[model samples]
Target: MLKKEAHYQEHHFLSSDYSKLMKDPQIDDAWQSDIDSLSPYLERLTMREQRWLIGHAIHDQPPHNIAAKYGVSTETVKGWRKNAIKKLRNM
Candidate 1:
């Protein structure tokens, strides 16, 4: 998950040397569509579960760090993530 969010955050006009691939409007639209599709599933998760997913996916925070912040074991954090993903999949 390291730098995965950073990759998504990169934009065409924001860079001095533009990425030709990101220049395509369809690529940007597809990315937005993917994000939009997750909204309903995300809404169904508990706040704790949502925080864990967003922290891992977008902030690149490791499970250990998230566990520490939430005062739970790393395994518990992992379990929460698994269950949250399962719920999202079932949705």
Candidate 2:
């Protein structure tokens, strides 16, 4: 019944690729590079957008869950996500 993407579980920071990258002690520069590239776009998101992104990507939470957390609806969460992505993209 989920309309969302089928790849939520693999999108997290602890997913295989990212975890393997983290395990490399010699990859601090790689980590820093990632941080530098992502920090600005992440900072551009509103707090609510940030929370939704974290809940979805990091915590693997669904739109319904996040909507309930904010006393909104699934569509609202989707709207927020749309705006968030637009802001990041336009940046």
Candidate 3:
């Protein structure tokens, strides 16, 4: 029963509101303004942080998945995100 409940929850979450914006090209520009606003701050991030952010935020990949891909630990990927946000905040 627990397994069935978990599967249902996972399916519901995945099926709902996933890629609602990018799936339709007409709405692709919806985020352009936000992107433009954040681009300057993003440029201040190191290339490593930028890559991690692109994978974690833009691509919606989990830190564990990114960590596995890069052969690093999940905490390290999360650290990159934390430090990147701190830098942006300080700026």
For model 1, how many clashes?
A: 0
Residue 42 of model 1 has an lDDT of 53
**Candidate 2 lDDT (Cα, 0 to 1):** 0.61
RMSD of 2: 13.6
The residue-by-residue lDDT of candidate 2 on 1-91, one tens digit each, is: 3535434432332234443433445436635555445545556565556556655764578999989877988998998798778887787
Against the hidden reference, what TM-scores do the models get? Answer: 0.54, 0.52, 0.54
RMSD of candidates 1 onward, in order: 13.3, 13.6, 14.1
Cα lDDT listed for each candidate: 0.62, 0.61, 0.62
User: Can you rank all candidates by TM-score, best first?
Assistant: 1, 3, 2
Q: How many angstroms is residue 14 displaced in model 1 relative to the true structure, after the best TM-score fit? A: 37
Candidate 3 per-residue lDDT over residues 25-65, each given as its tens digit: 43246555654555566566654465466566555789998
Runs in model 3 lying further than 4 Å from the true structure:
1-38
Evaluated against the true structure, the overall lDDT of model 1 is 0.62
When summed lDDT is taken over every stretch of 10 residues in candidate 3, the lowest stretch is 13-22
- Name the candidate that leads on lDDT: 3
**Which is the better candidate, 1 or 3, if ranked by lDDT?**
3
